[model samples]
Target: MGKIASAHAYANNEVAYLAWDIDGKIEGCLGFEVVRIYLEPDGSVSLRDDGEEDRVPCAAWVGFKGQRNPHWLPQTTSIWPVQKLSWRDLTLRKRRNRAQLRPSEISVRYEIRPLGDWRPGLEPAPDPVPETVAVAKRGADGRPVLDADDRSVKIEAKAYDGKPRPLGYLGPAVATNAIRVTRWIGPFQSTFTNGVLAAQWLRNVIWEDGVKRPNELMGMISDPKNGIRKYLAGDVLPMLRELFEQAGSFLLALYELDDNELVDLLLANKNRIRLILANTGLVEGEWDVRNSHARQALIDANVDIQHRMFNNSTHIGHNKFVVHLDDDDAPVAVFTGSTNWTTTGLAGQTNNAIIIEDRNVAKAFADCWHRMLNDPLDLPTEFDDGMPDNQQGAPFRTSNETPARFTLDNGAKLEVWFSPNMPARRKSSAIPPDLREIYRLMRKAEQAILFLAFYPGQSGKDCIVGEAIEIGRTDQRLIVSGAVSSAQAMPNYVPGRKNDRNDPEDDEEAVSPHTFTEANVSIVRASRLDDRDLLSDFGGEELTAKGGIGAIIHDKVVVIDPLSDDCAVIFGSHNLGFKASYSNDENLVIVRGDKALAAAYAVHVLDVYDHYRFRAIEAELRRQGKKGWSGFLATEDTWLDPYADGAKGALMRYFARG
Candidate 1:
């Protein structure tokens, strides 16, 4: 329709990514208007007695340069269309006041209609189909049709706005694939929090409501029925609640047990929960006090608790996982990722959680929990005195034997490893086994190497970031992109000489000039530009910092060659560094040959990286006294030239071909 070639969509729990392809060159086409049609789970039209099957018009917050307004009133794409071929619909949510339509339970499709020349004050055409009729079975003559199959039945039509001929009349709409807006991927499900404080939606909400502090903001959007809580915790809390309802016992190992809601849930289900609670080290007193209070409650209720009260900072149990066992004591599923069980961990930082429904994976994690419960200190029988950190032995020791390898029911291959398994006295040049496996993948990455991390161990040659940097330097054809929570997490890149990946100097801000210059590597730090330094259109609204957690990017993930058949996703509590492998209690999994899972993770990595890359660059440009380049859109179409050549062109081609 309308020379449109293809339309496709991908969705997670919170957002839908819609893209389209045109048949030929856009000779003089202005833009496109996207309309979303929320459908039933069976892919049937949404029929309602009170209202029409909501044909929601996707829109942009800002208008043209001269047409912009101070109120930030959004203009529907039907009038002011999107200039790009693809858009992310962050506004998708469950229909309000409908308890039956849960998050990730409904499906949606899109229609991409090309827009022509337009003028001011143009309104969309009147509705053609009546509210009483659910389907467009009749033709323009308004006569009922006899033969109406799924392929022949009409569901939508082009929009009109009362202009001449092609002008103000939308082109024929091309239908896109229908997909359930969910986080499930076969036996694996994942969710990510919208916890970036400087995000556009959060900023708009804060500016409009004058809501300050995390609790206030949380209270404003905490209604589970409306699915707004997904903004703070994604599906983590819901998934946990559902797991609690299951007829199973929970094996939970936590570093921080302070979220009141979670504590309440645990107490309610205390009869089936066995917890291994750890200390938060010599840290904040508030966290300690709250944790102690929560722990005492669980203990008072007689919950089976194994307290790993190691007070040292360097060697503490840093695991957050829950393994579910059936009533017969057989493993069913496991929940493990970078997320902690604190409100700040769920609502303050960007984090991820994965639910692996494979029994073997759950069993592996269950084994780790059992080992920790049995031997909290992981002491060696010989009691060696020449430990690396002047300790009796490693705090976690699942690394002595080979990691568990499994073939999932869906043909996905997985290798799981637990930490604190390093030998008491190993060669100085030896690499940690987990880090070694990650390096092997990094060295052999063909298409792209992407990652997101928050201080994944000290930046050095032994870390995954350093390995990616070295590979990107040597192979200019590869696409290597990464984002860390801070600049200090990156290595000090050098031009010709070796990078100082393992510098012992205690410099928080490491200089890496060759990041986007001499090498193909591009490392962006999670940051925001000062409001005063931004364009005048942005005004002087300050960014919000909520909760106690300082880190904004807490996800620890890596996707290698996500578009290829050899895709691998490395994630979990593992920090992708030596410390996590050799000294801390962590779990890392490597999934090979699962392109779907890899692509999902790749989308998330690129999403977070792209969001922060512009902010980092904008801040850097303003600091260098570069004006006009840091803010505002170009007045004319000259901005399109960059997408036809150079770095932008290469990136566009990479994804288009992939």
Candidate 2:
């Protein structure tokens, strides 16, 4: 059927035109540059060149209203104009009249065909072969034969030779073209391809290359921040806390002479056993001896206490309790050295002991303990065993016997030897004879004496300090530094003063100024001014002092002529105080050689000394009503005024006069 078309202008001078092309005649007109086009239902057509559809009317176009018959026809209609004109002429009459026509234009026409023998308003008979329909038939055999409809079939399949062109392997080229076509339809194609898509593709390729597998990749994606929170919260705090605790515990255990604290800790736990002993034949205070009431108390509580005899004639040494572990064959712990298993040693006095947790190290110490425990004849003792039948009257001949030697991991060899034996004499209960030997060695220094201690007390009460001063003033040059006194307030009368005189007459007697008399001794107060320079000029020098917490030179050591023609650093844990040297149970190892350790120790001591000196000076200045003198006192001269104006100066001058 043909359709009528129309175009009309509104009062606002607007017009619209609708076009119809029932067959596929409008396909050629579709292009990328075309702005807008709409197809109508009519068999006719209309055109608008101004690109404004609302200004034109659809009714103004011819044949747009279906002017043709509605019934089915015998043949398809063919509609075409005698001539074709440009779009410009189609809109204006003058332009259309001036346009020339050609035979080619007239030949460009449309054709449509109808079904055969079809009449309008009547049902058509069914054809034996319908267009594009497949017919199924059942024969006697009950099998269906399917045949394709003939009218709708095209010869294009046959037109192409038997060998149809294959899509084939376009490879990356085809993929690239397909991607481009897809990207043209959306604005986000560049972002997806270049960003996430590219990353995902690379990741897959990497996995294919065997660098990583898909499972590992998925695990990484699931939880990337694993263990981070726990590590920050728990592990770090506990590790650091334990480190500091161990450091403090080790230092305390090494220096404290008494085992009360350790004993208490072990006893409190109930599963462990504890024993304490002092070398036999060495006279000790009433509290330190095995028969003392204090020792009996611990024995009553099930703690073992033994005494080993070390007489001049006998070759006996104190037994050391060395703990060993079978698994690692190392020392799990070792309790040895000069510290006594007493309450004072554990709580009040300064002493040295080693607690090695390594099982291998413990085994080595155990070996040493076993060697020391054997019969006097089996081992080559350094001194005479006092047995008449023994060869040379001694366990081992000093000339033939090899000295006890130890080799450290760094390949340094240390030779141990006993000092010459002294005459047997009446023993005193206040101090042990072996300790007196140690004191004699410390006091016999001719040129220099350097002492490092953790707990130093006032002069008279501190036997080591008194002896050190006596020797320092008479023969040896002394340098003493350590943590003296407790966290409590300073004691009255500085330290070593006897309140009761042996004779009241002597106390009343006035002495001449020139006469030499014993007086109380105190540690030299270090000046605040000395702290500013850090004693750098004293580096590698012969004389120095160090004392403070965490100071590297912690071991109570005494070095004589270190790094000078003669050098030695006697170290262990014997505080240069009366209690540590005489009254309290203590231990000290005197090293007559080893210049390198001596020098390092000397330097370390000076560093600590400088620190203590600064603190002392600040304290003295503060006592003198001088606030913030630590900032002002930069030179020794500036410190002199404050020192003289305060009680510290009097004490220092009094000691100097003595």
lDDT of 1: 0.66
Please, what are the lDDT tens digits per residue for candidate 2 over residues 1-658?
2111111110000011111111112111110000112222342222457644312110101110112111101111111111110011111111111112111101011111111122454333222121222222323432233235322221211111112111111011100000010111110100000001111122222232223443442233223142211111111122222323331111111111223333444344322332333333323321223323434444567653333223322222323233423333333543343333333232112233333233333444444333323322222142212222221112222221233444434333333222112222222335534446546666555445554454454333334544666665664224333333332112222323344588555443321110111232234232222323221211111011111211122235555655343455554334444333322223333444544444434443433333344455445545555563322112112222333233232222211211
User: RMSD per prediction, one decimal?
Assistant: 11.0, 44.6
Report the C-alpha lDDT of model 1 over 1-658, residue by residue, as the tens digit: 2355667766667666666655454433456678889897678778667777768888555444434323333446665566655666766752222212245667888887766544454333322221222233444433333443423343442222122222244457887877676678888988777666655545444543222354565454433433344556767788888878999799999988777778999999999999998766434422244377788899899999887655544665778999999988989999988898877677667788889999999999998888877675432232221122322144346333469999998888999988866774332456788788888898898878999988864444467887888898888888889888755576753323333658635335434431243457788777664556654334332222443336778889999987688889998987777766666678888999887787667767767777777677766666556763433323343443344224343333444343
The TM-scores of all predictions, comma-separated, are 0.79, 0.31
Which pairs of residues have clashing backbones in candidate 1? Answer: 396-420, 399-421, 460-501
Candidate 2: worst-modelled 10 consecutive residues by lDDT: 170-179
**What's model 2's overall lDDT?**
0.28
Best model per TM-score:
1
